[model samples]
Target: MLKYIMQLYKSKRLKVKHAFSSRQGGVSQPPYDSLNLAYHVGDRRDDVVKNHKLFAYEAGFDFKKLVFMNQIHSNKVHVVDEDSFLVPSCDALVTNLCDTPLMVMSADCAPVLFYDEVSKTVAAAHVGRKGAFGNIVKNVLDVMWERFGAEAENIVVAVGPNIKLCCYEVGEKEKSEAKNLGYGFALSGAHLDIDAIIAHQLQKEGVLKEHVEFLPHCTCCESERFFSYRAQGETGRNAAVIVLEDYV
Candidate 1:
């Protein structure tokens, strides 16, 4: 059984559940050693499957109900409904339906999990450099607002472990992109606070600042606990999953 390294905020009267897992307590190998959840990263297929199973079990979820995306790092937000249990080629996913576990994969990229108990909606987002620039966070908020009648004030967001500014060095071209977007000073060279940018975007979308929680752990700095693509080029992936189970 995989040990869950997760943080939880208690709330009654809602079935919402979520977790940001670290890269520990599983079976893989060196380079991609142990707890690698992504199957596309050249890890052993069987081990990957087992790892997924262990993760689901540990996180108190069913493996079959878990939904994943191809994570193109685009602004596309797929609204998951009955017929769309599995969406294709999307970076963000939202749903008013309950019991479906939504997930976003990342190494250095940000994993943002959102829950709006009032609207009975939940979402997971992958916010990388390109996705952030493309306004993926705003897109997800818009979808939640329109589809589930979600109030920005009622939404709770968690910014999971990701590459912090200390290690997210970028080239001139990437910096220029943010600059052109009117967010010129967001990136601080060889270091970018992508999580903070996403948080600001959430505020822009009317989500209250107090409703958002930022996890201060850096993937690159704490590579032993979480996978860091920037720290280890061509490496494994970690999962940040959220599922709304049946209310007891």
Candidate 2:
């Protein structure tokens, strides 16, 4: 049995069953190189499935119960249920059900996992430039609260490896968009600081500053260990998964 190392946050809450996968530890060919978890990235389908199986097994969760997003870069958030249809058009997922792991896959985009110890709810979101500047985080927070009673103050967030200010250079148009959204402070020259923006959004939505943990890794900076679409044009994805604490 292969042991894939899923990066876990040193959260204060030990019961948060979540992880952020790196590009290592699978059987896909180079570039995709071993663990490429996205099926739409043109890697061999079998290889992608095998990668998923490895991830699930290593994380001690059933692969069949892992729910992921189709991810259109929108602010859409879905409340997942046993039979609430296959969510094929959302960038975020929230669930209070145990053993049902919610996942968000990304390359340069941020994969964020959430755990609310109060409501026993968990969520995963794929956050990119659009989502960082848009309402994706707020939307996920809303759905978690409204549908599952997951309070924002009790929500512990783990922001996985992603593109940060050092590598997140943006265009003038996108810069202007962030400015219009009142997040102009996150801009430093040509680079847009996604982490700062997310932090501000979390604070505005009532998530405590101490409860959030931002993983200090840049995919573009560590392309060898983590997948980076910006670094490799036709690349694979890194996945961030969260289940209700220790359901395996």
**Range of the 10 consecutive residues with the lowest summed lDDT in candidate 1:** 6-15
Off by over 4 Å in 2: 1-14, 245-248
User: 1-248, model 1: which lDDT tens digit per residue?
Assistant: 45544322222322467777777767888677677888889999998888888888888888988899988879999988998876899999998777788989999899988888887889999999999999899889899998889999888888888899888888888878888996766777556778878888999888888888888889999997888998888778888888876675
- Tell me how candidate 1 scores on lDDT: 0.83
Question: lDDT by residue for model 2 over 1-248, one digit each (tens)?
Answer: 44555443334443577778888788888678779999998899999999999999987788998888799998888888988748879899988888888889999898888888888888889999888877689999999888989889998888889998999899999989999999999999999999999999999999999889888999999997889989988888888888875446
Candidate maximizing lDDT: 2
For the record, the alpha-carbon RMSD of candidate 2 to the native fold, in angstroms, is: 2.5
What C-alpha lDDT do the candidate models reach, one value each? 0.83, 0.86
Model 1 CA deviation exceeding 4 Å by range: 1-15
Each prediction's number of clashing residue pairs? 2, 0
